[model samples]
Target: MSKQLVVYISATGTTRRVAQNLAKAIDADLAEIVPAPPFTAQDIDWTDPTSRASRQHADRAMRPPISASPSVDGYDEIFVGYPLWWDTAPREVRTWLESHDFTGKTITTFATSSSSTRGALGEQLHDSAPDAHWVNGRRFAANASEAELKAWADSIA
Candidate 1:
């Protein structure tokens, strides 16, 4: 079996739950992309235009440092997951990808959104990671089932 890793950042556990299910179904290692200082409830207020998330989203240069990374040397396939914020993965995802060298790996992103579409996020991240071989990504609902996640993993793997 190919060694795989499921890496994700969960703002409020939506992406975390999906990542956990996908990892179990595919027998892959699990890792979370965490913010250095952590995010508070107020910091994640997307509704407020003045919130931390809002400000950071508006600025394309905000690549906050990631505090955690699992042993990725053994994994050939990487599954990147996050909830869609402003139709894109958070900048922390870019921070993590840039920090690691995914030169010879296959990367596929699985994202969730309540109202917005994935909106070319996989392609948008191409600039951040030029060497990675990116596959087409899939979008899921915030409450997607384990079977739904497993099916996508199986098809992609």
Candidate 2:
């Protein structure tokens, strides 16, 4: 079994595509952190302050319930993927992180975003799993290539 795992949450499917490619490239196991009551198209609307995403992003304490835990046992390294939502990962990531044991593991974060910056991810992720070794993360364009993903995974390995 591969020691590495590629786990991610994608509300709009873009991050899911990237996660699939990254897992294939690195020959790692893959898992998705799904949100319970699942997100409707309207729930992701950033423009509406009343939207589910907007409400969650506006508040720090909202840890959205995930469907289940993607057990992290036996993995030495994990690459966490997500879309850069409101300058950080969606709150469901917090739900996923809290469910796992990351001690002695290395976590490298990567995200897909329309913005030029990777946004405020490192601190949030580190804060979620303080015992895990966190590394510098990268932001990828929506059109990021498979080769580029492979290269990044190889470098981390």
For TM-score, the strongest prediction is 2
lDDT of 1: 0.81
Tens digit per residue, CA lDDT, model 1, 1-157: 6789999988888889888988888888899999877767887789998876897789988998778855467778998988777778888888888887888888898887777775424777877778888987888777778788888877876
Model 2: lowest-lDDT 10 consecutive positions: 116-125
Report clash pairs, candidate 2.
none
Misplaced by over 4 Å in model 2 are none
Each model's C-alpha lDDT?
0.81, 0.82
lDDT for 103 (candidate 1): 81
Clashes of each: 0, 0
Tens digit of per-residue lDDT, candidate 2, span 12-78: 8888888888888888899998889777889878899998779988898888898866988999989
Best by lDDT: 2
TM-score of 2: 0.92
Alpha carbon lDDT of residue 47, candidate 2?
98
